[model samples]
Target chain A: MSFSRRIIIPLGFVLLIGYYGQAQSSYQTGLLPALNVNTKLNRGWSINFKFESRQQLQRGIFGEEHDQDYEYVLSDLALVAGKKIGFDQSLAGGYLMRFRGQDMIHRLIQQFTIVRRYSSFRLAHRIAADQTMSAGASMTLRLRYRLSTEWPLKGQSVDPREFYIKANHEYLNVLQGEDYDLEIRFVPLLGYKFTDSNKTELGVDYRLDSFLQDHPRQRFWLRLIWYRVF
Target chain B: MKYIFPLFILVLGTFQPLSAQLKFEREYRLKSREVPPAALEFMQALPFTKKIRWYREEGYQRTSIEAKTKHQSKRYSIEFDTSGQIEDVEVIIKWKNISAETRQLISKQLGQNHQRFRVRKVQIQYTGTPQALREFIAGTSDESRVTIRYELIVKAKTDGQFQRFEYLFSEAGEFIKRALIIDQNSDHLEF
Candidate 1:
């Protein structure tokens, strides 16, 4: 397929989904933006620092009284350390701090990742587990798996000044005391490589949760991400 | 605010050094008409009926055109310069294809250099005149006029640090030279 057509098809699909979302009472729309910095260390080790924030753009049911006012959501700061165990696999551990209005939450994370390279694209698999803690609340634990693929739009690989497409599908199983639920997420992104150490991506992150309950919830977020390496 | 963080990161990224020593390599697919006529002519003369894919590679201060295909269960890669002059032909082969003595020597050398090592790929490379290579590929010529070398991709641990390298060896399994294969950062995929 032509590069422009490839981009346009998915974009159109996302727009269609957005249009459909307006009629659903359980839908919420927001913006998600994040910045990440990665640094390499000695002996096949690396570190990453990330900051992310969320904001609500619109909410409520279609053809009814809806709240369209902007609202600030929450912020997250994370630090991770990674070790390359093999040419294609790595192990990592991290910590995250979340600030939500007057509440503060902490999370501990561990993950394993494997990446495979093909002639014209790359595929990645990740399995992770995390535990979240907050004052006066039961501990929550989540287990997740994600599969993602990336391919250059203009060449065999994504190089400086080139464009690429990345898509991810993930499933999460969550547990909090007597409660258990599942969430699924899909993200499709358009990325631009500024240089060897820098890149930016804009995309839509769609999540479906609460399906195990009586009222299922859906979220659509416009996501912007920036990555820098040192 | 959301705007402040992204702006700060963009400014920081703009200041990062573009080191001259960093290697830049890229490959692009080419249409049949986009390739040099001479290269296409040479390809047309081959007896193989398999589909051939053409590519243009830019790296190491030079650009080269490559044709890749599979024949009789073996993978073949033929490279040519920009002016359509043939450079080398490489065929992926098994480690057992090498003589037992040569394999022993190669293994000994690798064992001596690294605490742990694994061979990922092995390719036998041929370099000679176009006529000689054509005859060899056709099974009508001997190795008298054609030079043979072995190329291997290896991942090894040296001094407690692991790295990947591309190694070249002579026909007798004597070590020639090795180059480090720098991997692109994959933070986005991992995190």
Candidate 2:
């Protein structure tokens, strides 16, 4: 009875299946394909949970045409708690889960992002953290800024069709070269506004890249983007 | 021969614009140091990051990484000679963050949508070479449609997350309205 055949066979099969699914998921994909679940649990409170299997491959079979090629896949989970200070300013913080392959990365990063909104502009800043993967770890002391903008086209269409733009800038002072580098993007976004409390974002964005000194070679080239929010 | 080469260099260098814009279309394997003293000097001044092995697809060269910077972001491409002398310093591109108006519009759109619409799919493509985008949009004297386009999905209040917005940008990276793509919704809203 202690070693019941029923329990043994099914348990062993389940374990085998779990192991196989995980095994095949590796090397078979570019990055860890995961899911992102975002919910507004309550007013001024939200949850951003993500789970990704992290595995970064630099210079794989895809690197022949180019010199360097890599991909990063990761899963994370986070709970955000915040309150609206002003009519449009929101302050929030949360926890996240870092995953590598089938293993869970233990580094926890506590982040504070300021979601400040004006009647016409909404600016979000990381306030404290540089390209960090570890908890409370910041790369450089300089501040990193990310700015996003949108404009509604009037008389053009009765629809909620508006324009969208986003910008991310990183200030780095490495090896004593104080520098500021920026990457800006703009998308003539089309939004659908509802009479009540419904809105949707649909548009294509053109990404143009520019690099200042204190910077390096990157995709700061022109790119195309397709985005949807409904 | 040496004297002639130097003379030619001086003549062309003098006529070059005070500031030139660089494009990635020229070469896949970018190595100004690919030649001589320029490489030697850049290597010497190579900041700590300069040693941070970067390739065409990886490192800072990743197209997406560059695209993520602000619209007003600026990139510089410098070439040095074997003797460690500066050969050329050109502004690859300069961009500023999207206008404040544009950002507000996106925030409003992302904030109000109540449903999770399925992405039929997504893609962005360059109309042609940077020169082509410049020539097509610039060669014309009018401010009409440009070669560069912004194509995206548009949703309808009718509840179907279906719609498309296509905008064109000129070679100078300015918005062009005549090139816009707009259509009507099936269950149009009658307000």
Fnat per candidate: 0.63, 0.00
Task: Give me the runs in candidate 2 sitting further than 4 Å from their true place.
Answer: A1-37, A41-43, A50-65, A68-72, A106-121, A124-126, A130-143, A153-163, A170-230, B1-191
Per-residue alpha-carbon lDDT of candidate 2 for residues A1-230, written as tens digits (9 for 90 to 100): 22134234433543343344332221122333333344444343444444434344332122233434455555555444443332233454555556645654343334445443332333455443323343343332323333333332332123333333333332332221353444333323344454212344443322222233322222212222222111
Clashing pairs in 1: none
lDDT of 1 by residue, B79-160 (tens): 9999888899999999889999989999999999889899888999999999998888777888888999999888898877
Candidate 1 chain A: worst-modelled 10 consecutive residues by lDDT: A16-25
**Best candidate (score: lDDT):** 1
Evaluated on chain B only, what is the TM-score of candidate 1?
A: 0.84
Tens-place lDDT per residue, model 1, A1-230, is: 55455446655654454455445536678999999999999988999999999999887665677567589999999999999888788999999999999999999999999987776788899999999999999999999999877888876788888899988778899999999998878788999999879999999998877656744567889999999999
List, for all models, the DockQ compared with the true complex.
0.48, 0.01
Error of 2 at A182 (Å): 11
